[model samples]
Every structure is written in C-alpha cells, then in structure tokens.
Target: MTQDAPRRPGRRQAMALGAGLLTAGALPARAIPAADVQPPRYALERGARLRVLRPAKFIDPDEAIFNENTKRFTDRTGIEVRVDYVNWPDMPVQVAVAYNTGQGADVVIGFGADPHLYADKVADMTDLAEYLGAKYGGWFDLAQVYGKKFRTNQWLGLPMGGTTSPVVYRRSWVKEAGFDRIPNDLGQFLELCRGLKRIGRPCGFALSHAPGDAPAYANWLLWSHGASLTDEEGKVTLDTPQTARALDYARAMQETMVAGTMSWNGASNNRAFVAGEIGLTQNGVSIYYSAKTSSDPAQNAVAADTEHAEMPYGAATKAPETALTLNAMVPRYTRVPNAAKEYLRFMMEAEQYDRWLTGCLGYWSQPLKSYAESAVWSSDPKLAVYKDAMDTPFYEGYRGPISAAAGAVLENWVVVDMFARVATGQQRPADSMREAQRAAQRWYRG
Candidate 1:
C-alpha cells in the first residue's frame, strides 16, 4: 500500500503540499493514449427502472445532483435511475431490511462502514474495481480496504468515493482572537480554543450521538494521538497511553468549548456555526454550503469568511486523519448488476464525478487519485484544503482489516461514547478508556 511509503506526505509535509498545490486545481488535465477500458454495459432485457437508496450528503444535495446527472445517463442509455435519499444514520438499517426481505436498493450508499458488513450480499465488482482502479491511477487505501473483504481480494462494490472530515473554521474569528493562522498541532489547537473562547466565539466538536460528526471527531483525535480501534490482529487495542493522552486533550478542549455540545447530534455543530454560535468544528464543507446558500446576510458573511484546514496533528507525525467511504453496492438479488456497475462507472468518469463533488461543494472526496486534477479545488481556495483529505484518511478499522466487528463497534458508538464520557465528565479519562476497552473487547470477541 502507498500508505506506508515514505513518499506519501506526512502531517506537516502534507500541509505544505496542500498549501503549495492549493493551485493544483488550476493545472490542466493531460490524458496520454492508454489501453481501452470497455465501459460496463447491459442489455435491454433487464428493467429500465433502477431504484437506488442513498443517505443524504452535505445537507442532502447529492440526491438532486445525482438525479440531475442521470438525466444525461438516461438520455444516452435509456435507463431510468431513481436515487432515494434517506437520513444518514438510517441508511444502513433501511438497506439491510430491504435487502434481507428480497427487495433491494439496486445501489446502496455504504456509509458507517456498510460495505464490509454486507459484502456477501452485494455483487462482486473485482473486475470493475480493477478497471476503474487502473483507469484512475489507483484507489485510495481506505477505498480498497472498505469495499473489499477482510482477507480475500473479493470486492463487494465500487469504491465510489469518500468524505474528508477537516477542521472547518471561521477565519475572521481566528484573527479576531489574535491568531493569523489556524492551529497546526494539538497544543496550538488548545490555545486557539482558549482564544476563541476569549473572543466569545467558542468552538466545539459535537459530543452527542451525532451519526457522523461526533464519531468523526472522536476518531480524528484518537488516530492523531496514535490510538486506534484495534491492533493489527483485529483485537481491541484502544486502552493505551496514546488513547488516554487523546482523552486528556479532548477534556481540555471541552473546557474551552460551548456548553451544549454534549447533547448535540451530527447537524448540531453545522447549525451552531451557521447561527454564528461557534468559531470552529470538525466537519466536511457542508457548513460552507449551508452558509453560502442561506438568504440571511449574516449567514452569507460567515460563509464568506469560512475556511478549511487540516486537523491539528499530535506530537507524532504519523497521525492518519479519518474519512467516510461511500461504496456503491448492488444487491445480489438485483438483475441489473451491469446497470448498477454502469452507473458507478458513469459517476467516476472525469466529467461526471467532477461535477458531483463540485455540486456537493467538496463534501465528498474522490476515491480515484486522478479526480484530484479537477479544477473545483482551485476554483475557490476554501475547497482546496479538502483536496488532500480523502487522499490521506485512515479507515474506521485502523491497523486491521475492515470487518463486521469493526462496523459493530462503530455502529454501537464505542469510540464516540468513549470521548463523550471524557468530555462530559462522566468518567475520568483513564476510567473511560478502561470501560471503553472492555466494551470494545466484547465486539472484538464476537
């Protein structure tokens, strides 16, 4: 894997490349002659109507965009594709129920590590995955790990793409607090939090049962501090000094944050920021999308000043930021596996995927490395930070294979609850880590 390669950018190094390549989106695309890739195709024997179930993206705009883009697909191929957008947290459960009942979402959005959980039920896409992988440079490590099974090389879905959870903050508030730059390390981040509090614009990472943001922040901190959900053997390994250290830092950060963060869900931090209640939070660029689209002048101003930066790294330079991968899995029961594969191939094409990510406003990062050459990031400097996010994210099951066990841990909120306990003073950092270790071991044993 390129992950362990020395050439891959480390923490500060990635930031440097990030700042330098901030204009990479301005670079022109160059396509040399290469081998032909037979596009995925299907006969008219299968029904034209394809039903897809997907969770919302960056305020659920992905649904409309996918619907709009498929118009071109339908126009060209005469396939009627309908994408049904559901709540982010509810997506997995809904798909599971539908698929188990002999019904199927021709394509299901694999969030919360859904791909690994249903690998056997989903159609094998090894040929398609390899085609796209070779066609588009290579798949991101998380993409490969998430879509494929644990030990074998079986692929259950197309590694459609992932979302990078970077630190989204208000530049004006940071400058108002007397800092010209966002924090680059944990110590600086804490100080920045103190300054934001001083300026009456406290920042917070939602600690509630936020389906996305809460667990995202928890994993970011843990991985940054060199803690992980499991060891290489896929055993529970979260109760370490590194984990305690992360918890301590989170506790100190909690002291500087807004009071109501503990009760919040995924949308809370975004809403808080849009309402001008917080100065910073860890999220995709959805906050910018909301602020920019809002009719209120104040909201527009917040959008104007909003910027994205890397999550502050811990003392170790090996920190791997977390990401969410959306695998497009076609159920085994679906007769239109070829059609579903075609839809995936369509979305990953240069023109189609570029517009999709742009329409999502950088909320979704591409699994294909070549997609980085798109001009969307350079079109606006704010979206540029996320350009490197998906490129360097650690999957949910760090240092271990992606498995149902990992999904159970994540779905049960073991890590999120661990951090929430520390932040809410429900348990001492070490105590919380110990309890969480026990809780996680139960899943690991299964």
Candidate 2:
C-alpha cells in the first residue's frame, strides 16, 4: 500500500507493536457538552464538503484521526469533509499558486515557520481567538509569540500539534562506548562523539537542507551556546562573539557527522540515523514512530536500542530554550469562520487531543501541559525519557510579531548555501556567517 493509503490496518499493527494499550484510564476527565448544547451556526451541514491539503509523508496517523473525527463531525452535524495529501516539496508552491490565484483548499498544513512569509495569502486567525478562548478555555500560550498571536491575534495560523527538536541516540552504542549516559554538557557531548569516532563509529549530526533541517540545528546550537538570533528589538544580531563560538562548534560537528549528510535533507538524515549508520543526530521525535514501523527491519534497527534526551546544552549555558512549534490557522478566506473556530476548539479537548496524538502515532508533542505531565507520557517507559525534555522547552519570542523578516531569512537558498559552505570547509564560519548575516540584515531592512 502507498504511504497515504488508509492506515486502519497499520494503526492496528502499531497498536500491537508495543504492549501499552489505549486504556480508558488514559482519557482526560473534562466533560464535553451534551448534544443539546447549541452547535455553532456555521457547523457543516449534513454532506457538506471541506477541502484540506497537507504534506504526504507525515500523513499517517494524524490524517487517519482527522478523517475519522471529521466523519464523526459530519455524522453528528451533517457535513462531509474531503482531504488531499500533497508531497512536502509540492505544498509550498501549491499553496503559493492557489493563494495568488484565489484558489486553494479550506485548510493547508506543513508550512512550518514559512507561514509568516505567506501571511498575506493565508487567512489571519486573530478574529477567531475570542471564539476559541470561550470554547477551548483560552488559546495556547505558545501560539502567541511576543504578545501577538500568529493566526488569530496577529491573525496568521492556528496550531494543530506542538513539537520540539530533540537529541536522539542509540543507548546501546553509548553504553558500549563507555559513556554511562547521554551527555548533557557540550564538552562531554563532543568527548562522547570523539570517543565514538575513534572506535570507527562516527556520530551523526543533522546539518542537511538549506533552511529546513540545517537552520533548525543551527538555531538549536545558538541557543545551546546561550546566544539569540534576534534581540528584543527584533534586529538581526546573530553576529555576536557568543554566536560565533556556537557556529564554530557546529562547523566542527559537521565535519564529524556521517558522510554524505551535507547532501541529505531532513528525511535522509533521519533514515541514516535509524539504519544504525550514525551514532546520534538532532531531529524531531516523530522519526521514532517512522523508524519503528518501516517495512525494512534494518531501517528500524535503532528503534529498540535507542533513547531520547533534551537537546544538549553549552558549557556556558546549562539549559537552552527552543520553540514550541505547531501548524495552525484561522483562514481569512474561510467561508464558515465560526465552524472553523469550533473545530479548532474541539481539536484541543482532551478526548479529541488523545485521538489525534495516538492516531499520529506520537509524531509530535501533546499541546496540553497536563497531557505531557500526566501518566500518558510517563507511564509509557519508552516515552518517559522525553518528559524531562519537555519541561523546559523554548519557543520564539512570545511578544513580538512573527518575524516576516526571519521567515524570509529561512527561505533564502543563498543563506542556506553559505551555511553549508562553512560546514563543508569551503569557507570559514565567521566569513560564512557574516555573509548570511548581511543577507538577513538586507531582508530585515527591506
């Protein structure tokens, strides 16, 4: 079956992949309103159709839950929902074309931080916030960056699921290398990597893609080193000496990463790590689900042997902050704004939230702090390791407007290419960062 094929069977198989069953006890306690509670006026009518577009690869369980819940929504309210899965590479262009032409699905997913750049094309979600606040008991805190909310407040997008970048490694390999545990400090981490390499087992660090994975790693390293990409005034200030140190360390790590990663995109890097060819890599935890379930057993070799931890920290900074990422929005063009708001509210409830997370097979973080802190995460031995990592997670500025300038910086291929050049030794880290900083300043100024 194709990757996007109906995953009912796969869901069942995945349920059986581990011993932890979806227990009734796992459900949250809050009571949803009775049927008599007046439904939103814009709720879909019986057989009404809604169009959705999202990336193809990440479709698995989230799509399944979304379709199933949507069917239930239709059944309860008499509306039909239709969804279309697009390849990740095609989604941005498709969204761009559709938005420019005034034609596109009612909902789209997988843009990541790019929506800030496409704000004009996508609907502003701010108008729906009051409705969401009333329904979902206030909006997500992380959704509002720097006092302005992106989708509704600033009116850009809404969150579907929350996620963070984490360090994934093979526990067994680390144990064999004489390291008792994953390193928390930068010095220890580098020592661990060198030790692993000296034994002919090179460690893997993700530095792939121009803006996607590479920048994510670079940002993480910057944080790890106690540096900020932008200060309170929203200026481009990544050229500081501290940031320079972080970039220098990243370049060194890039040199030791598994061969060919410079050409690898996000998925390729994950595949190489899962295949046991690399010792460690920084990436989203979603790869854990994919690695475990891949048809080729070798592709999942590290699944059973691996463990997760918070992203490593710098010697100077004990803990670094990262973004609480999500995909969400209230479209300005939505015909049924109230209905969309209602759906967004429902999506965040504990019951629906559980279904979405499980259905996605644990690709992203649970948005509710209660869910992450509860037994749902801790009781599962495999996932418990991640709980500590979530406690101190970081996000972009909560008070500032989503930086259209920063978003553009991320989209520039030239900037990414320059970073790659430094990583591969084609240029010095300072020179490459200076070139990229100049480009970012130009974008910010323009």
Candidate 3:
C-alpha cells in the first residue's frame, strides 16, 4: 500500500484559512411572534441577537450560504446574528474552552454525534416540535436514524443537511478502461482498479486514518457486507465474521489503490482526484461539486466527466450504507433559545432550504422524505443521481440518546486508528477491527 506524504497543515493553519475565506454579512430581521403567545416563548424580539459557533472551514459550501442566509434573517427580523467559525481540528478544544469560560454560543454546529458529548448544554426540543410540526405539515423524520420513531421532545438537535457516501468516478476514465458501467461488487471494483492501474492511472479512496472520513470508508465496507457497528440493543458489533470478510476484501483492494492515499485526508483526497491522479474513488457528493466548480484549473479534471453512483456492494448484499448526516442544535444556555428555535424553523422553510441546498455545492441531500420525492429534485438532471441513490439508503444503527458522543468517539479516534493501522500494514484487518470494537466498548460504557 502507498503511504501519503504528510502535507496536512497544523490546526492553526487550517483555522487561518477559514478565517480568511469566511465572510460575514449584516444580520437579518427577526420574525414577529404572535400575540397571546408568551413573549419569551416562541420568538425573539425584533432586535435580538444570536451568537452561533461552528467549524470555520467551508467543507460544505452550504455553510457559507447559511452564514449569508443568517444575515438575511437578521435583515428581515431585526435580529443580530454573529457566527464564529472554528476549525474542525480545533472545534472540540474551542467548544470546551468556551463552555468552561461561560462564553459558548447560543447555537453550535458540528457532527450529528456531537450533541451527545454536550447533551447537558443543549436544550430539549420537545416543545418546539409542535410548532415545527404545524408549520412543516407533520413531524420531522428523526426515525431515519434508527428504525423506530424517536421522541421529538427529547431530540435536542435537528438535521441541518443530510449526506451520503457515494462512488464518484471519472466517467471518461472508467469508460476508457473498458468498463461500460460502475462496478456493483467488490471483486469488479478491484478488477476495474487493477485495469486502471495497468494504464498508469490508479483508483483512489479517502481512507485517511482521520476523523470524519475514516469511519466513512469503514461503514462502506461494513454496510456493503450487511454488518453494522451496533446491533438493535446498542452493543458494539464490529467483530463479526461478515465484518472480517469485508475487511479482508478491503485489505486486498488496498494494494490496487493510488500511491499516497494512506496519508491523504478528506481534503487531500479531493485534491488528488481533482488533479487527475486518481481515476475513481468513493466519498461524499460534496467533493464532486467542489471539483466541478474549483477556480484552479488543475483541480477540475473531472468537472464535466464525473458521475455519481451508489456505493459498490459486497458479495452478500446489494444495498449500501445510509448516507452520512450532520445536524444543528440550540444550546440550553443560550439567552435566545426561542430565537434559535425560530432560526431552525426558518432554515426549514422551502425557499430558504432550496438556497441552503444549492449553495452547499451539492454536498447536502434532502432531509425530509417528502422533499426528496418532490418535483424539484426529480426534474433536475444534476440532482437526479442523488435522488436515485436515496431510494434504498440506510442510516447508522443505535441512533438514540447516545448518538452524539458515540458517533464522535467512533469517527474521531477509533476509526482513525483502525485505518492508520490497516493502511500502514501495522495490523491485520481483523485485529484492527477487534481493537476498534474494544475502543467502542470503552466509549459506550463511559
């Protein structure tokens, strides 16, 4: 397996890039609360200000638009909103420091699993469900996480945008390699990779042993073989035979991957693909969008030739894992909790949602089932790939009260270490997975 050179900048450099690229606009006007409602119950007064803290980098283009949209809200509602962009690497530390210093923002955005880490700091959203339900025509679909319905009252966070890991390939390159269609199984995928490699171009993947992308690749393998990290009772379950087989398949395929992939993080993977060093890869749809719109000419290699397909399958199952999702929440300590709720409500409005989705540079998948089925997406050729993929998408199991903390630990450290070991050949796939299971057990027990 090829090792990627260590080119990732320090956390401070990432933060500096975010600070430079981030642009904040004037706050928008606040929505007026109706009379007979408690003054402090549903909405902020016309000039109320809300402070929001989130990762500073623009991984998802929708965030930048969301920042601008928040200003529009302020413009309309006479509310003042301030967004603090913290780098992903520094987010945990910054959040902890802020909360410790009593300086946490009214709203905080991070991974869907983050709320569990700071559950005590987030407000229970039960009361707002009634209002959201009445406004949106029904209850929000928290059930997508697990098979059962979640109590909306206890749901402290709302999904900001949804995402899925898909196989993004170079249509031209794959076709040139004599593949008429993207492979459907691991064997065919590897065969295609080997074919591409012979021609001096290699298939690539975002298999970095880092937060966010590591578990993504792991889930791709686990779900492809019908395995899951947790069973219905919420116990760790990564040591099964199916999981082992899947890992074995991955290890074999690793030999066919592009050079330098082992060290490439999410951003680097995108960069490599856009630079035309790799012929195919699996990742979130957002990367495809960035490549298509990048100002740098060398990074737009697949701009007009890329295609999105459902993740490849394993020997046993035809279905892929559920798409990754990110959520938004209001903190319990916000002086403007009502305002924050109203902001969430505003975000879900059809017009605003469209802007948020489109602005995200195709990173976001529709959250509401009804929205996914709407004519707007069905008719758009550019978005049809995602629409088709969502037909049978799956989500993580055990998406209950522990979703936040559990997800954080799994994505941030456990999965990262697993990939690092496997990619570097320091441990066998089964051994790495067993270690990962131990890590998960320790986290769950905590």
Candidate 4:
C-alpha cells in the first residue's frame, strides 16, 4: 500500500546530475513538407528550456535519430532542450524520484502504467494525444488503454512506443531439436524447452527481479493460461484453478531452463544467447541487433543463426500480453509546460517520427497505427514479427483498469515472485497462488 511520498516543490530547481546528457544546440533544420504537418499553437514562456529523461538506447540509431530530432526541434523553435538517457530498468525509479522531488526532467519517457501511478502530478495530455491520433490514423487500442486516465478521457501520458519482446531463438538449434518453429501450445512449448535442454543449450527466461525480462514472461505466463491478478472489477483474484495450472506449467518449464536463470537479470538472456549459451529466450530485437552489428566475427556468426517468433498462447487462445511499453508525461511541476508539450508534439510528427521509427530497426513498435507502414518492418523479414507489438494486449493490469494499485503490484514484482517461487520449487502451485493473492489484495483493497 506504500507509495512514493509526494514532496511537491512550489518552485522548480535545477537538477545537478549532468552525466549522460545530450545538450541540444542550434543546428540546421531538416526540410519537411509544410502542408503535411500542422502543429497546435503553444505560447512558450520566455527563455523556456526543457529537460527530458528517456531510456538509454539498445542500438545506436535509436539514440542518433532521437538526438538529431531533438536538435531539429531546437532548430525549429528557439527553446533549449537537455536530454538525459538512463538505463531502462532505472526509468521508473528516476521518474518516481523526479515527481516526488520536482527536481528532475520536466518531460519524462517512463514505463507502462507509470502515468496512472502519478496521474495528478502530470499535466493533462488529452489535447496533444487527441491531436496526434487524429493526424495519424489513430492510436492503437492498447495505446489508448495505457494513455488515458482510468474511467476518463483525460490523458495522463502519451504513448511513445513498445518494444516487441518475442522469442529470440537459434534457428539451427531449434531445427536440430526437431521443431520447425516454437509451438503455440503450452505443453509443446515445454517439450521444446526440454529438447533444447537435452542438447545442452537450454532456454532461459528471467526469473529474478528484472524490470523488463521478468515481467515480460511472467505476465505472459499468467495471461496465456487464462489467469490474471485481478478481475474486471479490480478485485484481487489470484488464487484460482487457472492460476495454479499456470504456476505448475511454469515450474515444469523452469526445470528445463539453464542453470542460474533464477538469479539472472534483464541483460542476462541477451548476453547468454549471443554467447551461444541458451538456445531460446524472450527478448526484444536488441540481442539480434547487437549481434549483427558487432565487430567480432563470432558474434556476427551468431547473428546469422538468430531468428524471432511471437510468444506462444495457451488457454487464452490468443497472443499473451507483454510489459514493453514506454510512455511520455510532462510533470505539472515544470515551469514551461507549453514548451514541453511542443517538444513532444514536434518529435511525434511524421517528418521526425518516421525516421526515428525506421532507425530503431523494429526494436520499437509504433503506438500510432499509421507508423505500422514504417520501412523498418519491411526492411528485413526477420523484423516483421515485431511489427504489431503495440497492437497486442499490454499493461500488466489486464482484465481490469490500470490503476495505481496495478502499478504498485507491478512495482513490487509480486507477479514475478509468485511465478519464480513455483518455478524454483520454493513453493507449490497452490502455495504460490495463495501468497500472491494475499500480496495483491493488500494493494487492490488499499
């Protein structure tokens, strides 16, 4: 039931942490068709300067295009911007601190359900979100689900994009194991893992407290098995037969995983897969990207063998959810709200966003439906698997509204722990389900 104590400062103060910053300078603006782009008018404050915080890039082009676009925004407008890139896992903590202290970035690109957790502390982005959605085809259903405040049209955040956490596997190894592709059936998937294990190249999914990896699989495991932490009414309903089946399934899968996966973090699987340690793992395109772009010949060899497939489905009979979205919010504590909004507006416009989308190489799927046509998806057939990530079910608060309670449950890693306990044999399926029920109820009933 605990939340970050809101120490809302009355006046804005300069943040002293200056490392890992890309300061925007006056640079030449790239030409875009004036008729194609018409942004809303915003009267920026005098000497308006913005500080933005976003996740560090998994590949060079994502950062390069973003920095170039930021410069273009600065070039188009006279406002100065300072962008800070932090590790992905650190985004939630940093954003929490920023809102609490009112001394970090004015505009933050945070993780899933973050805007819900700090809704009151952020500016209403409904105008901006609506404008962009109208201009583009429209935001995806999942984007709207994560962007808007609970039971209201007010937008607490703008959906930036989501990473497609597909199953990254070795093509040769899987074929050698006698499976042409990763199976959609839960039992078949487990058998595939066992086959991979027998060949000494076992699969691994983060079972530890990894911010991205743990939840990606754990949430998928829950939804794929027709279980959820809460029902549509936001009631804690983790203790169920469906949930027990999932826990038991996870326990069986974990038995076939690589040793020490119980202690692995977000980056562990990527490193392991690239090193030929694991035959299969769930991750974004970062692993394949790094391998293909690496200077080492051995890593490049691994890249040739890399392939991707969407996560399998179980009792849900559909693609399971993944925790991969990144959201943008302008904290109300900012002195220059208009300038902050303008910056996001400028960045999202197609002239800039198209390049950024193409530059990301399919690691990030578009929130807007129109961006689905970006060349990144078609540039390589291997990347096509990630093209519709945002269209899939997302937000760990499935079957219920994404509230602060859901955010708290995710932040506490309750779901990850519940699955990990069963997977590691620390608790039986029933015991883990009961423990998770008690833990989730404390938040839902708070």
Candidates 1 and 4 compared: the better one by TM-score is 4
Model 4 CA deviation exceeding 4 Å by range: 1-38
Ranking by TM-score: 4, 1, 2, 3
Please, what is the TM-score per model? 0.89, 0.83, 0.81, 0.91
Look at candidate 1 and tell me the lDDT of residue 242.
Answer: 93
Residue-by-residue lDDT tens digits, candidate 3, 237-307: 87788777777767776788888877766566666677788877766655555554555565456667778
Local accuracy of candidate 4 as per-residue lDDT tens digits, 45-154: 89999999988776666676788889999999988899998876677789889999977788999887999999889999999998898777788877888899878889
Which window of 10 residues has the lowest lDDT sum in candidate 3?
23-32
Checking candidate 4 for backbone clashes, the offending pairs are none
What is the alpha-carbon lDDT for the whole of candidate 2? 0.58
How far off is residue 332 in model 3, in Å? 1.1
Q: What is the lDDT of residue 38 in candidate 2?
A: 41
The lDDT for every candidate, in the order shown, is 0.74, 0.58, 0.61, 0.80
Indicate the worst ten consecutive residues by lDDT in candidate 1.
Answer: 1-10
Q: What's model 3's lDDT at 227?
A: 71
Candidate 4's TM-score reads: 0.91
Report the number of the highest-lDDT candidate. 4
Model 2: per-residue Cα lDDT over 58-138, one tens digit each? 535556566666676667556455667765546567766666666666666645454675676665555554444454444
Candidate 3 global CA lDDT score: 0.61
